[model samples]
Target: MNLARRALLEAGKLLVVLWLVSVLVFLALRLTPGDPAVLLLGPQAGRPDAAETLAQLRIEMGLDQPWIVQYGIWLGAMLTGDFGESARSGVSVTTLIVDALPPTLWLIALAVVISVPVSILAGTWAAYRGRGWFPNMVRFTSTMGVAIPAVWLGLVLIIVFAVNLSWFPSGGYVAPTEDPVGFLRHMVLPVATLSVFLSGILTRFVFAEATDVFRQDYMRTALAMGLPTRRRVFAYAARNAVLPMITIVGVQIGALIGGAVLVEAVFGLGGLGQLLLSSVLNRDYLVVQSAVLLTTVAVLLIGYVADIVYRLVDPRIAR
Candidate 1:
């Protein structure tokens, strides 16, 4: 009963936060410098006709309505899966998001797939052999990777793999229809760039957690029971250690999305990151709202799932 009540309370809190985010997103468009009308129109749009155009834009954009009324309309549209038309491209926001989602999913999915297993394995080994040179090397690499900004690291990879080595394309996105080989080639550097940094972050958390877990009383008991050392450490220790790592992973989902923007711009991948940049610059409210909302929802969803999984992994946690 307590656990169920707690879950319900958390869900309610999340909904409140979502509503607040909606209001903040709504207000951000009004608060930011420059008029969307002027941005869409021109610098010389101060004529009498320009005034008319601005009025029309205000109405079209729901800017003429009360703040609460406008928010209700936008929220209704969002609830109905209508994210509004893009001011820049005149396309459905959903179409843009759907088209852009695959690449980002591919990038994040591939990176996480590579990172989690590798990090877990390496972390386990390092915990088993903390004093070894290999563990020290892993520690140093993770430290350096965490310190270096992902954007800079992405540029370094581009220079080495694309510019200098001629192994991959440097700029521009290629659709699979255009050239599959060229498309994949363009993805390699950016995907790898995201993977490298994310891997570093995951590895650090895994190593730290695993090492601490190995010190527990139950872990010592498992070993004293004549179980194989690695088995005792991993099969038992991993469970306890993993709960804390779940939070780290949950938080990193947000960082990964944000990092994707920087990496995408640097690599010229036409993912949501690039779209987000264009939206912010042009004050495309719908696109901006969609981008930020999707990102927030994604991280929150990850956190929710992590909480559920953590409970399953250790039933005592729900107590």
Candidate 2:
């Protein structure tokens, strides 16, 4: 298939996945035990007219409507970019999400920037070493990196770096505009925590790819031709190995968004993960639904982009 046709097909898949996600998120929240109206009117529930107030509030919030009707109303509003207001704070869900999104984006962007090159270099070096102590150590470290919990890693970093050495702050976010140095300091541990996890995962894949590339006939020919060590390993071998790594990186980015929840919580960053968690706990249905749907859209789009890049890099993929 041509690029245009492939893109159109991928776009269709994205739409279908998003629709399914919307349905699942909507139903899942409603199926949960607590009633939003009751949660919203917690203290007032003991009043004599509490039942009457709850009934009125439910009607106003459209909770009295059938599931299909509620879904229809929400879908319609969503199409027009109206995510509705939060049940607890009465703030626009869109506004709340927009506010929380930047910190998470910064965390992900920084982690990617730091991790990708580091992983590629480490993996290529490991593969080049070819069964030495260094390669064995890299493999062992990657395994432990993948096995370690991000939350636990975050706490350990806090104790060693933040508490003991006083090199970085333990938690809380500061906007770069307010104080760039402080912002970097606050983010160092969280970013490092996320970067370590992602690097661990990416390095393994890179090592596998690079190892295969090194074994290729062309790579052997380059070595026989007395190609410079750097040029042979990087320009020839690493370049070929990195094409498949694009898709791997894209998938990791999506996973990174989810993983940020734990890292953000540990560090107290007011990111989307924290917002989604709080909304769910408070039974803020609209916020929860919108956050989940938005996150699904991001992940699906990232995967779609990765597929496109993969096809572009190796046109034979379209076959």
Q: What TM-score do all the candidates reach, one by one?
A: 0.90, 0.97
**lDDT digits (tens) for residues 1-319 of candidate 1:** 4667877887887788888887888788778998787787777577776888888988887778898897788889888888989887789998988888776776777677777777787777787687979999889887777788878988898889888999988877777678888878878888778877787888888889888888888777877789997677678766556667776777788888888888888988888888888889999888899878877777787887777667666678778
Model 2 TM-score is 0.97
Q: lDDT for each of the candidates?
A: 0.81, 0.91
Q: Pick the candidate with the highest lDDT.
A: 2
Report the C-alpha displacement of residue 179, candidate 1, in angstroms. 6.4
Lowest summed-lDDT stretch of 10 residues in model 2? 310-319
Stretches of model 1 off by over 4 angstroms after superposition: 43-49, 174-183, 222-230
Model 1 TM: 0.90
How far in Å is the alpha carbon of 190 misplaced in model 1?
Answer: 1.3
